[model samples]
Target: MSDALVTHQDIALRLAIPLEKAHEPRVNTLIQDSEELIQDAFAEVGRDYRLEVANLLQRRAIIRVIREMVATAVIVGPYSGARSVNSSSGPNSDGLTWDKVPEVSFAGVKLTDAHRRALGLVVGNDFAPSWNFPPATRWPLRGGDN
Candidate 1:
């Protein structure tokens, strides 16, 4: 089993975000979000083996999820702009309107093929099953042994 795994500091370093003690909560949340998906994708892999998987590849996967989450947060967060003046009070026609604002949605993240392979998860094209039985020698082994 691998001894080391991805950490919040590793993610911050990967994304070039300034690491602060105060950011730990948010970072931990992000890691938890990514880990849930990771766990689902790699359900067949034992927890111990998962820790031993390629650290770089796992970190990359986590980084992708983190980036998506950060983008969604920014989009849904408050908008920073100048104070708006009442359009009916002045002759000026310049103003911001929400009539054409597009709907914002945060689609949950999915594990990529690379990420799955790195974490020892089965790929869609690969059909090998994890069976414990020995291979059969012959097809017909019923009544007589001749």
Candidate 2:
């Protein structure tokens, strides 16, 4: 996403860190605020279609950011995508309320607001079950499974 790339690059330039390796926790602060702005924009709109569009874009952005950075930094997920729709249900149905469709969990350290926004820039607000990131006893934050 251009928004994420631009934000990531800005941090890289200001910190004199490589574009690929800049410390993101610091820069993502501004990004999170901007995303909140987008949400606010949706709130002002009168149409459901317009609001849903914004929500889709935000989710895509979150997915992109997480997919890109998770390899090196450690992340936790082998999460499932949304399940197939049920033919019996009407086309507008929310698919099966199946108990085990999406497999999200904490991927590693629960990201701080800084990191969470950064990750959100990747995955939006979509829930993800379970993250398979390597254990980080050294990281100040730890997932509860320990």
Per-residue alpha-carbon lDDT of model 2 for 1-146, expressed as tens digits?
46343364543444422544444653364445444544443354432424444576655654344333332122212332324445545555454433442223233212333434543323344467567777877757677856
Global lDDT of each candidate: 0.52, 0.41
RMSD of each: 12.3, 20.5
lDDT of 1 by residue, 1-146 (tens): 43324455655665544667886676566556656767665565555425534566666655565455443333332332323434665676666534322222233233456556655667785786766788878878778775
Model 1 segments more than 4 A misplaced: 1-4, 17-23, 44-109, 127-146
TM-score of each: 0.38, 0.23
Off by over 4 Å in 2: 1-23, 47-146
The true-versus-predicted C-alpha distance at residue 63 of model 2, in Å, is 8.7
